[model samples]
Target: MAAAPRWRERLFALYFLSHIPITLLIDLQPLLPAGLQPPALTELLQWYAASFRDPLMLQPPEWFKTFVYCEAFLQLPFFPVAFYAFLKGGCKWIRTPAIIYSTHVATTLLPILAHILCHDFSKAELGGPRTQRERLLLLSVYLPYLLIPLLLLFTMLCNPHYSHTEKRKRK
Candidate 1:
């Protein structure tokens, strides 16, 4: 029945604060007009999409494109909600969003990992990560997608008030 520790609350607030810009710049920015975007932001997007001869930057597979679209549409909206929930420490409202985001990340990452592990590199259409360093560098971007959602889910599960009914049970 005790509230989560001060450090935990602070951690969540910081995590959520970091998520806001990622949602805006990475998830939501491309949907807006260029004139409406800052020149620096536009350049960042260009570099994000086209830099380093990245497979995602280059011609990606149909499945990867589909995942990108799905993530943009479905996952983008949750960023604000998750941000708010984490900012507030713990709330019943966090439960559904946490579950949805967690499931989404799990579903999205599993197949990508599978493809990476199973695919024959020489025949890849987009010329996927070639060297060990390149593969690790590419994964640096993706591993957070997997870790963040799981950590959010764990935090929600640990929250004393993750269910509103718990508030009454404590009285």
Candidate 2:
């Protein structure tokens, strides 16, 4: 019998499952056509942007859009695979892919976090968070995307099941 999933594996499974809808609905909205986008979901995205003072979502720059595209094309596909693997537990096949996914996501978030912290939002007509408080609030929203992936990367890298393989012995 396979080992039951640990708490962290279950948590990661939940993360992957939750990410699927978020990607399809909110994260991929900027790339989607108005006709293709659902009205209620679009409203939810708009509400999140306004509430968070997220200029990146409100008026996405080319670079930010590129990131969203990657999320749609790449990470979106991986979510289901990861969800299955993590939920099943001890499937070594997931390790490399999980490592790659975590690294890519964590790398993408660094620049985004920096922009939130350092960008001169006031200069833009459609500005982002202008005050420190607003910026912090926005940062809080983006931070989990960074922190969780980093945690996954660390786990994948350090865990023996993920990092080591057993060799088959022949007579």
Candidate 3:
């Protein structure tokens, strides 16, 4: 099986590395109890919500909270492992886990993207995006998460090195 380019693996490594802080500082903030959340990070999350006009972050519904819980319990733990594997490059063990992680994240983002595109945040009184421009802006913020994971899923499934193992023949 042909190896995937080292640059691709390195790029993925950087992504996993960057996601660690984002998950801790922003994405997981909603799940943390007020007392447990550091004031500075909490303030950062608030700024993100206000600046992005992201109602989901500002007033997360129960369904959104469930996604956060999955991030905390599932995706969060996998970040370090992915970081290591991608950094090392060609750790076949990572393929399955990466496939699973990417699929799960991509799946979660679909509903979120639909909400951003279709929901009438103005009528909902959720302090969400009131205008089409604002909704598009919020959608931009969430789009990368979906795109990157989908890319990873594609790489995992289609990259020969990731999906196929070669047997060593006796000399």
> How do the predictions measure up, each by TM-score?
0.70, 0.92, 0.92
Residue 63 Cα positional deviation in candidate 3, in Å, after optimal superposition: 0.3
> Candidate 2: worst 10 consecutive residues by lDDT?
1-10
Compose the digit string of candidate 3's lDDT tens values, residues 35-134.
Answer: 6888888788888888888878867899999999999999999999999999999899998899999999999999999998988776665577888888
- Candidate models: Cα lDDT each: 0.65, 0.88, 0.88
lDDT at 67, model 1: 70
Q: Rank order by TM-score, top first?
A: 2, 3, 1
Q: Compared with the true structure, what per-residue lDDT tens digits does model 2 show for residues 94-140?
A: 88899899999998999999999999988876678999999999999
Candidate 2 at 167: error in angstroms?
Answer: 2.1
**Deviation (Å) of 171 in candidate 2:** 7.6
TM-score of 1: 0.70
lDDT of 1 by residue, 82-112 (tens): 6676677646666877777787777888877
Please tell me which model should have the higher lDDT, number 1 or number 3: 3
lDDT score for candidate 1 against the true structure: 0.65
